[model samples]
Target: MPKPPGKPRPNSRPYTPQRLLSLAVHHEVRRKTQALSAFKDAEDQRPPPEPQLPADAQAQRHEPAAYARRLAMPHEQSWGGISPFAKDYARIVHSSAFRRLQGKTQLIPAGENEVFRTRLTHSLEVADIASRIASTLNHGSGAALGGYRINNDIVACASLLHDLGHPPFGHSGEEVLNERMRDYGGFEGNAQTLRIVTSLESRLGLIEDRAAAEFAIAQAEERPRGMNLTAGTLAAVLKYPYQLGATGRKAGRGAVAGKGIYEEEMPVLHALQALGLGLSPQRRTLECQIMDIADDIAYSAYDLEDTLEAGIVTPLDLVAPDDDLLEAIRSEEGVRACLGPLAGDMHRANTRIVDALTQVFASLFDLGDAYPQIQTDSVEGNRARHIFVARTYLESVMHARHPMVRRQFLEALIERHIAAITLVADADAPHFSRVSVEPGSRLRIECLKAFNYHRVINSRRLKMYHYRSRKILGELFDTLFDNAMERDPKIRGLLLPDRMHEQFRAQGRSQRREAARLVADHLSSLTDSEALRLHAQLTSGQSATFNTYWR
Candidate 1:
């Protein structure tokens, strides 16, 4: 029988070695019980607030119906009702694009370690963090977000779908693809995410009629307008609203020239504008701002988590003053800009946090060296160690008010200089917003990024792998482009599945650019392992096996 809460266990053993163990266990239990009792006593001493609507419920009441309206489709008429935003969430969650994120890299490749985040896990984390930020903004003490209540579902869907466009091997692969398709409105992951959610993902199943599906298909023959997500959800995902070629035209300050929507995706962009999400040539919505920030937060926090678990960098290393790392941070253009006047503050805060973390880690692990070696061999042990390190670091940062103030200063710099939302006069483009990170935080993030950049990405060990991956992609791209130019059926078969091949063929000679785009898309869609396998098959002149062909 189980003992009642806070009840002492009856003594049953004599004072032997086994009895000593039992007493130790009982003493630990008693300590926990006393701690719980103290917690309860403290809670009982505090006065309770007057009962009212839960914060979330209050916030939901202010959310407008227009924000929930679906694009090109009516809400489902079911006894078991669901919000249109919920439908968007369901659709994205069910998408092949979303599922494929599991196989894609974050900082490190997936399957490198059990605790390391992949694009899928990272997306989920981003979604969670984005939703939290939205909820906080909506219900927290801040002034009612200037009459705009962020929808949590919309933010969540946007966050979850944000990295859907990232190809295999992560940003390296993205850079390679972007180079290959430079003429064809270069590949941007954010833009690809927009494409996936708006046009590439199918939503015909919701139409409930053959005619509607055909009409939808006919309206956009080259690429299908995907999930047909609500305007609010779509708006939240449009980190960059302008087309690729229009980068230089009246772009706002701090706006990225290279990252924007593809030319073909403009129709859907216009559709979103028509729905009153107020998309300009270069602006993103508040929800998008929140999601983007959430992404930053997650990446900044988790990347360190991943590196630590992999034993590539130690907490002690970060805390310790390495001239090389400091020089790298100082040299970064973005960091330099932010730390212009606040360089001293940044250094002080950075050093303080690092020192605090080093002390915490040293105390926990009883460090002998300046940089302690972390456990990474066993997955469970690595995870446990990572958790301890992460918790200690976070708690240290949070408690150290100076660092927090410096961080806030950095955030303020971003808000003041980098992030901007302008009210525009054009009826077609009502609101323009740009999201940017301030230099201080950006510098800190860049430094953290540089840790991986110097140690892992550009290291002798990984450089060889990157070089080989690049070669494989380059070769594949050249061969496929040649075949696409010749209109070879085998190449077409390799480029796309049967249904998509028919669509590609339907375009004829005019679709050469489209064919090239298709090749890039096919290459980008492959997992790292899949890309390697296909590369092997192509290079060796071996007939593709079931594993290589099926995906």
Candidate 2:
């Protein structure tokens, strides 16, 4: 039986910045130690077998069906006539984690305006774009994808689930969580995403149960298996395929700094690699590359639309080159270097799109006068104008008449070259393939990203919200971490939901560290509003009739 909860721990030690940083480092070391112990135990039990694919099998035709092998989950294997990859689609669509994205942030705060994208909407758009890209590659020139057929379903699932680990309050919340977890192996949205899909999510029960049963192990010892998705889909979702901590690979170009799976998740990574499915350990798969590019396109195109609708920026602002802003953008070394040769073409393209969009906006606001007014104050009016701008912009690029269009096409062609999957000719173990992007499009996308980063994300208005979010999250982490270590029943109950609290208590001697991580995970899972409400409750002792907890 578990000990009952009790009062909060004494606040003798103030949570100084230095103290928190020290604590974070301490926890990270502890996590790595525990992980090392586990790794040693697993290694002692059995040496990992060599990958079983034949040398000739390495050269087999790279088709979609061949790569869509399901994991050895009983439920996953029994999906009656449904395509193996399609099960991945269904599993992701029906997941609670995926649904929670609706309440999570995208660019602006969710519910600020119905028209603004939430993580959920962004994910759906990414899925659509990824699928379209895959379909285009599948049918439009097989030579473009290096003779390997693109798997639309795999790409779609990967795209839809890419942002599953983003916490409430967007990147702000993620930053806070990472700081809090610094000692506990550090938190990352992508790494957390892998954890969610493999262990935390309860939808599919334990993936190891099938193996445990074969060994006649007791049911009580079973662990969670996550969604038990197919190997191909899982590979596509791994934007960074390294592990966390010192033992992990160094961050390379296009990879997030120190981003990878948690130490506990190495088994899952190894299991996926062991399937003989031709996945490389170092590089992303071709489908992953497509999903990544689609993500870039959707984010650049749609987030700009959201900014326009919010009136924070305008189509005219993007079109009309502000010399100061242009100089600032070009001053960046990479931008200057990449845009050097393309300057003439980019300028001409920008001029045409801006001029065309200006006319479209004018027509929308033309209330029968020689001159047009910018009628974007009204919600309906703004939405109408946004639609016109988006359509015109998309059409302009699709027609490929503008210089930007030609550059974009050339850039994509270059991406195909870099993203080509090449099987190792003689390696005993399967190695991953490298993915790259053209310098021009990469720089252009960076500039577009910077436009949002500077114009909207760092604008005076949103900074206020971001600052407040940092405070709320910081206080929430401190309060929960303090109480979570207490032996008191009431404090423990308040710190987490019953299920989570029970799990924390069950850790016994390691409850303190486990409690801190559980708190971080719990906080990361909250919606924006939920985080705000809980902060109010914990900080100000405010009482509300509504339930603020989210699973």
Candidate 3:
């Protein structure tokens, strides 16, 4: 879906035109009221309250309507008995930020080809997996799960919104953004996602009832309130519970993100804790854990399917692995746990890997099941028969059949893991219980992830793409950074888009950290192709670009 001329792109939740227009002063008012924080010690920006929410936070887990938003807009609350989480799901589904995901990369550059999945498709798939997990929990757990059902809408919405902050070029882009914004509260995709829904989307409750506009004004909030998701959905979307501010930065994949919420969102964080986002096991909601595992399952299994469909890796290639592949697998912590201490002997590990993978494929695919006669022959003959049949009908049947096979393969993989999920009560934790997969399923997921990473993502071809992507993002940041620092308004305005220009205006020179973050936010919001196209237009004199093409 094309982004609306501009929207958080969370769908409308029924604010009247009078109210939306009345709240138009929100952004301006926010700039005046709240000073954007400098890149200071993160603790200085933290809420004064205790580290965790109240002990009774779990008490409200069953009440979806009681979920809190950044701003309390009671007018938006009365959805005719509809749970607020359902509205959040709708808000996300129709959101601009969510739709922009179609243009963002998942693994490969988005919009370059139809075959590779983009962030949007991946999110939708995750949502599908997540909803299933939610249903399984709701039914399987029944009333035994603290007498309250897991909210399916909250889980699905969290899944859909989980990747909202992933910028173009995937993880590499994330790295660059984090480095550039290191002092500016840092840039982790998840944190940026939180920012998008809470601040960037800039939505207010549709004005139909109550003094919603007055409520926001009373709080001195003039900026958009994002999707104003229920505290339940907010907790679910917050897979990471800590801050990724200046002092808290880590060095690896999880390093930059820290807890996945920025210092800029301290108020939102405090609101969540106050609203009873139960504090336990790192503040992860059951829905959040469900979303996290669903993400892992999809990332591990579906990416391999994409690799196969793209002809990047053949099944035979996986069957006969290379030394590098085995080495990669050997180094993974999860794979090591799953395969045991093959230690330095990767050759033996390779054999085990091949055997295990073959077994997996045999159990999951088993192409010969459709042609029972072929199975009656020698195994080699049966394999040959399947190949011959595929080659013969390569155009008519095989081409169409491959997608079916891939789809079925994916479904089987999802089922394998999803079926293993169980609702286990966390007696020591705050929430009633959490959804967990068996240890065996987790090990298998890790092994699949290792295989996909080493074979597909770790390929030299992808490295080259990433290297170039890094360059493009870095250069774009550099140019934009300079433009932002320009003493002359004309030169500054030349490169920056209208939206970014407005942001720069709201930010003061004293808020240099804020300026850096503004640039990072601008860059992070772009799609893969837009990043490339934008790089060219911003860097060169010859290329002319327009926002209409991208925005």
> Each model's TM-score, in the order given?
0.70, 0.68, 0.78
Task: Compose the digit string of candidate 3's lDDT tens values, residues 1-551.
Answer: 11111111135455565656645555346556774422122212222121123335545546443454434443353345455567787889888888889988788667668978999999999999988888887787765565566778878988999999988898789988887777667778888998888877855655532233334443424445777776777778776666665233331233332445788886787777676655333446677889999999999878878777766765555555777777787788767776676745767766766665554455433455555655557987788787756644443234323888768766787798999998777544424466667866776687678888788777876888889999999999988787788776555534566666765555534256766777887888888877888887767874674452334
Report the C-alpha lDDT of model 2 over 460-550, residue by residue, as the tens digit: 8799888888889889889888777777664553667766766655554335556677787788778888888888887786886455553
- Find the candidate with the highest TM-score and give its number: 3
Q: Tell me, by lDDT, which candidate is best.
A: 3
| Rank by lDDT (best first) | 3, 2, 1
lDDT at 378, model 3: 90
lDDT of 1: 0.61
Better of 1 and 3 by lDDT: 3
Candidate 1 structure quality by residue, lDDT tens digits, 490-515: 45544455545655565554366787
Backbone clashes counted, model 3: 14
